[model samples]
Target: MVAREKLNQLKEKFGGAVQRADMPCNERLFVFVEASALKAVCQYLFRDLDARYVISIGMDDRPFSGKFMVAHDFAFDQDHLLCSVLTHLPADNPKVDSISDVVPAANWAEREIRDLVGIEPVGHRYLKRLVLPDGWPDGVHPLRKDFAWNQVPEGYDDTREFKFDEPPEGCTVVPFGPFHPTLDEPAHFRLYIEGEMVRGCEYRGFMVHRGIEKLAESVLTYNEIPMMAERICGICGCVHNVAYAQAVESAAAIKPPPRAEYIRTIMLEIERLHSHLLWVGLACHIVGFDTLFMQSWRIREPLMWIAEKISGNRKTYALCVIGGVRWDITAEVKGELRKVLDKLESEWTPVVAAVSKDKNIQKRTRGIGVADRALVKNAGLVGPVARSAGVNMDCRRDHPYAAYDRLDFDVITENGCDVWSRVLVRAKEVFESIKIIRQCLEKMEDGPLQLTIKDELPVGRIGLSSVEAPRGESHHFVITGENNRPRRWRVRAPTYQNLQAIPAMIKDQQLADMTISLGSIDPCFSCTDRMETIDLKSGATKVWTQEELLKLTRTKKT
Candidate 1:
């Protein structure tokens, strides 16, 4: 929300500590704040300056600093724009005072830092093990450069210590996922059902902790890492890849040409459209509306076809490179994309009307999974989930990235703050994405897509890139130079942050509605692949390991 001029004023206020400010096609000013003032600066941004804390990224330092560095990113709604205020924290004894006091949403990001980087955000009320097992070693942060692979430290234990137990009276807790019949991604949730009503809930995940950051530091070059990181989340492939590429470009102080920008935007919107359509199908399934679900996915096939034709893969498109993009949209390809768009635009009205008027859908999703605006804001919800709850926050419209500034679209908002509203927001966004794509097609001109750059990048360089993925904002941080590969890279999938609000939204809803509500969040468990069962009355917990379950099932079969 910070204007160009106001950002300049803020930069002037900080002077030297504010290193290398650039607005990057997006309205956001990538300001590198000094470590000393991170907490205070975040407080100022949230309280007096209208910005709210989004999330944090921790990365390894290359030459200038120590083993790692951290950036606490913030966004605001002053002019309904998404701008960032980044604070850099040194890796040695990397400690920054927690801003949860000013911005409650910092809690999960702080927990992530605790789990992955071993950096303690001082004053975080609940800094227990999150995303990692409790028995995981203290100093062996997975995101750090020093973490040893293929070997556990001496005397290290594999067991985790769970903190919660025992549901309240009248509450019947149901443990759904790390793996579930309905879920496509792995994440665990304990739903407290009071009869049919959900009194409260708890979330636990991160089973698929592949050490992507550490892996990027170890094996891949800068150009290669984007392809590698794109696999971080199967659904949001373009988001992660594009953000990572942008981060590296920023660190290297290079900009992709105008043609590349337009291509990136087109890809981004196409991905967004595809993701939302998939969510629509999932939501319909949750309500047992198979016909609608089939229709939604059937409509979605063309989008996937386009992704395959353009990027050569349906899921993990290796389309992005460090300097810019790996491929360009040709005249024939552009014409084909336009044809697909025309089909999509024509279907929009009928789909929206059918979803809106369906009595069965109304019965299940109308008032289910309601979360208060304050609750959502405090949890730091992002993307469609936040916007559905009347948050009025969209990283694309608020933070103009790629070709967003040159293109036009509305930041769709819904004040309903319920499952139905969230569905509506996504449905509306499908139209807006089509609108943006049409504009891009109309205005796109011929030029070079990827700019040529030297193999070696500048040393001690750091860059941050955030794009509005289908679900929400996907953030990437790159740390490395001369090597043209990041010494350390942090990838924050939107599901990493938005999962916090799942508990808040499903509370007091019915057991069946809980299923519907879960679908509303459009979950992608980027780090986790499984679930844990907890005692409803006593909170006693037990993780049903996959191998154990398989063994038990085999014995029964025998």
Candidate 2:
């Protein structure tokens, strides 16, 4: 009914511009609008309706619809609805009005669409190459259906380099990474510093773009993607696994059994516990508080062990299938899990108390890397980053899935809007995760682990899923197609949005605080770089040296 009301509101305002709409359920709304009106509809939803911008998706639908498709997803958090405004573009010249001017959060996404899908965002002010490598040939869109998964486009200029923007007047450029002591993965940030203060920054990441989405749409089947999806992030792999399964289920109107839902809830919270503890430890280490770093990891180890016991792997649980989960919480595992939670809470409480009162840590982080409510709104920051700024948005609470609706817990928030605030939020959230897991263990009922799919999934139905990763919201978009694969599967990790705010967050801050400032959002470059490489040979694995790897990357040849 609420969805219908919103649909009616759109129809009333836009009339014929709102060509058609689909209300798959009370929680999901899909509106097809004229390509010309896409920008206005997005503005109305984002500004007037106060919908939170999630992500934008570009699809090459020429084989099926003979037209390209673009979708901009927004979350009406208060209404518990996720709405996507989609429009068709002419296949020959796929272009859509750029909404980045009005929706500042869509800047990188629009650029990425232009880069990978070759769908130009008309009137976009800064259309730099966001996802593609410098050596990748221009005008060869890899995501297009015509592009094969293994095809290497000719004319890849290995000697080509990225053209970075010039620094502001009187600022000295300092290169932070492609490799740095603080970074866990390869991300280059050219910091523009003026008198020990950061004036601005230019980020050149996606060094590990793996082409996983292309594989999903072209090569992988429905169930195979879950395994590959888990690899999206080393830490949050299970989050992607569950999110992908949920997306497919959502698009096909297939619900996982209740017991499987509870299992998913448990696994997700388990992931949260480990991720938060790991992040808190790393945050401390970044700020020179090695004591808490070691202590936090000490408390986190048991959770990983329990996860392995429950799902067989330490990190990638391989837990989800299309309709349900692959793992279950048996009685013995449940009892062990409860004991682990009890010990974890007992050990973690004092650490949090000490850290809260530690003046040294506070002094270092209190005002470092501030992302206020305005930054959150414009950048579409999520999870602890948004929560720290007093933005009450959580996918678990706002857009419930799995057994989160059945489980009751607090959404921890902080008003500091800085690195210190993020610390407090993630610290406090550990307790909430423990509470959620315990509730799942208690309330989980006996039922089938998977639903029986008697027929192939219906084609061309869109699915969107948002799972709250420890760092932020992990969103996935899916369009079911023939050959048991998705027509287009787009994953937007939390880091994709959170990392965009780094320039603003670090601006005007002390140059020395850059590492902790970057660490505060718990940036995961692996999640953001969702591409991959493959080896088809049956011989022993051949490890490439740095020189060899560089040559391979530049050439893009087998």
Quick one: best TM-score, which candidate? 2
Tens-digit lDDT string for candidate 1 (1-558): 345765666666666756656665444466667777667767776766757566676654524465456677766644644445555566467787787777887777777777676777888987767766655656766555565544455545545456665788887778988678788866678877777777887777766666666656766677778777777778888888888888787777788888788888989889889988888888988888888788888888899999898888787878778657777788898889999988987876798887798888878888787766677667767788778877877767665667888987898889887888888999899999999988988888778878888557876565667789898887776666445566656666777666777777777666777777777878777632211111122222334465577788889554
Candidate 2 local lDDT, 238-283, one digit each (tens)? 9999999999999999999999999999999999999999999999
TM-score of each prediction? 0.86, 0.96
Stretches of model 1 off by over 4 angstroms after superposition: 1-37, 59-69, 77-94, 149-151, 159-163, 527-558
TM-score of 2: 0.96
Q: Rate the local accuracy (lDDT) of all candidates.
A: 0.73, 0.93
Winning model by lDDT: 2
Q: State the weakest 10-residue window (summed lDDT) of model 1.
A: 529-538
lDDT of predicted model 1: 0.73
Estimate candidate 2's alpha-carbon lDDT, on a 0 to 1 scale: 0.93
Error of 2 at 163 (Å): 1.2
Give candidate 2 regions above 4 Å deviation: 532-558
Give all candidate RMSDs, comma-separated. 5.5, 4.2
